[model samples]
Target: MKRRTVLRGLAGSAGSIMTIPALAQDRYPERPIRLVVAFSAGGPTDLMARRLAERLGAHLGQSVVVENKTGAAGTIGATEVARARPDGYTLIVAVSSSHAIAATLMRRPTFDPVKDYAGVAVLGTVPMALAVHPSFPARTLQDFLRVAQDAPEGLSYGTSGAGGIAHLSGELFQREARGIKLTPVHYRGASTALQDLLANNIPIVMDTMASIAEPYRGGQVRILATFAEQRSPYLPDLPTAREQGLPGVVSNTYNAVLAPAGTPASVLATLNGAVRTALADPTMQAFMASNLVDPFPDPTPERTMVFIRSELEKWRPVVQATGLSME
Candidate 1:
């Protein structure tokens, strides 16, 4: 009887061990998920994360909470997510600055943008707008160029920070515009940059359309041109830099979702599906449209990874040329 009992006990223990992973897979998200935004609450990245979290929570049947961990050009929050458990509960809103630009710009990057995290879904892409205060002398791109060329010191432009996409776009524009140099005035974020522009502290700014949309519409700021291959649907009348004789000056920033590397494939798939559904919703589309951001053509993890890799490669030389460091 004792020998028979021992055998049964061993069999039960083996069966339980086999069922553990299956149970975890079945109950993927048994709790609320945390979406980390590496920027401040009012920034574009945080806005996108909050909007997506709302619909993602509905689709996943679990609450999705957004936690802002702003600092170090968005690396603080990204590092937090990179070191998180690969259970799909913790994710990060990855941006071009935090992932692509920072990878090369930062002297000592805390996380490997590509290796430390697995792509979940791409939220969208927004073009950088070259805008100026309404009171500024230049109203058109030509006028701005002429002013920049005539000025010995060049035109001053404000950016969110030194190593961000906005700063890079300004640099690229200067390189492509020929004889047009821009003195960069770094601010804490786009909002602050916009504030300085409104106050006439800075003559121009290169920032996301969403950041300047209200001011542009309110007649406080004027958008001279967009840094994109083509005109944005939201600002259809506005011409792109390519159309304005700066062919290679196109720059568009994108936002994406990422999970810690080694996350279960099933969990990643579930998250991707939820993101796709959320992005397709009409309300989400409207929000994106209002912000002058285009929905990503493909929101899948594989596509996101490919896009990220391409971006990283594309920006490596650009960052190197700038010799910008965040150490």
Candidate 2:
């Protein structure tokens, strides 16, 4: 009798659970939503977040604001989201650096990237190209590798930080190519590294497309190859490193949406729908193109989580192998 009673109780609970989504879909975002960007304002990630905020607010009939809470390689912003109310009002749009390296970088992070947040959607990846000052004399990936292999001190590459995606990608390239030894020069920001690269203080830099495009077009730098799987539409002449024989050289900075863990599943679905709508808007699409960011496909919750997990696994070894840490 007790067993039957328990089974009936379980059926009742499952039926009620099914109704929650219907209830949530009817009325959500009773207040304005906050989208937090882990980095400072005016960068690619920030721009995307702000654009998303405007579109998302329009779709949801509420004001969505983007707040910058930059620090400690995105831990400051992530921690704030992790501790937020989980009422679906607060969201974080972040890159791989925050999700993959924060735990390993910090001596003690306030929150676990995976445990503290639910992966909402991976916006899209921004390609990082291997560029060298035009005066360096390397016109192709092979030529650049050959020179680095021959150099006794190894070739120096500049990146934004010690454990950043750029730093890890540089180390990955070094290991994959085998012959070349790469010495990383960490900078406070891409702009600083770019300044040094322009001055020829650093001959090479593995930097984002947005950062290096102007200089490359201005004849200050030459792009050997982009880290994307295929040649970029914006730079068709430049080959990918993978096509140049280093198949493992695929690297990009991916941005995604994350909400505090245990947020209602209904809220997650709503946010995912909003992301898809925002990314597809013609004006937003034009903005992304101008910025060299590709809009991601299928912003489903499952796909987003799978992509983040894959990225985390992909970079974990590179981080450990390179001995990169925030400390």
Candidate 3:
């Protein structure tokens, strides 16, 4: 009888242990959650974070607060998220520049992109536009390549900054365009680069569609091609580099959500579900459209990790070719 009683106690203990995860998930997000944006407020990353926070709060039954921790090319915010408690309360807005590109560009990486965090979901991707001054003599991507091939040093392209994805895109373009080379000019930001392009000082500028949207729509700048695997839905008429015969010259700035490593699987599932629901909302879709971001077709966490890994591999050689590194 005593042995039976002891066995029953053991069974009960085991069952309770298994129930702990369920109970923890149920009680999760008991308080306000903090979403860290690794960029300045009002930037694209911050905007995405705020938008997700609003919908995530509703889905999780808790308030989601956004905090800006901008610095070190977005490493400051990412480091904080990596070191944060692995309880799902603290999360980060992960971007390709900070999470993937930084790993190869920075002299000393503070965190491991793949190991320090659990990917929640990929929010979306922002494609880069290759724009030029209307009078620069290249109306289409083919025309531009011909001109570049004819006079490799005659054409010059500008990017947002050194060691950025846009800069790397230009590098990749130069390498893949087949005997075509263009001088790279670094600017403070895309807006400044676009300004130069408008002034006819710089013939080409590769920047995000959002950054150059106003100029492109205003007819001040002409976009030759987009650096994406597929054409951007925002501008379907525009041709992608892949379609233009530059197969591997694709560049996209994607944003994702990640929690500190070791976050419970149950909590990760809850967070991923909340993000998926939020992304499907009509309001969210409208916002993303306005911001020039395309919703990721498959946002599962596993896919996000795979995408990040691929991005890291894709940019490593490009960054190395540029021979640039950030302190």
Candidate with best TM-score: 3
List where candidate 2 sits over 4 angstroms from the true fold.
Answer: 1-25
Q: Write the per-residue lDDT of candidate 3 for residues 149-259, one digit (tens) a residue.
A: 889356779998888878888888888886877778999988788888899998889899888888888899999989887988888888988998888888999899999
Error of 1 at 40 (Å): 2.8
Candidates 1 and 3 compared by TM-score, better number: 3
Instruction: Write model 1 residue lDDT over 160-252, tens digit each, in one string.
Output: 988788988888888888887788899987889899899988888999887787888889999999887688778788888888788887788
All models, RMSD in angstroms: 3.6, 3.7, 2.0
Higher-ranked by TM-score: 2 or 3 = 3
Which residue pairs collide, candidate 3? Answer: none
What is the model-wide C-alpha lDDT for candidate 2?
A: 0.85
- The order of the candidates by TM-score, greatest first, is 3, 2, 1
Sort by lDDT, top down from the best = 3, 1, 2
Judging by TM-score, tell me the better candidate of 1 and 2. 2
lDDT of 2 by residue, 1-327 (tens): 999999999999999999986676569977899999989998778988998899999999999999999988788998999999877889999688888767666666788777788867888877888999889977899998889878998989999877777788898899889977899999998889989999999998989887788888888889999998777777778899999999998888888998998887888988888888888899988887777775566868778777777777878788878655664
What lDDT score goes with residue 259 in model 2?
Answer: 91
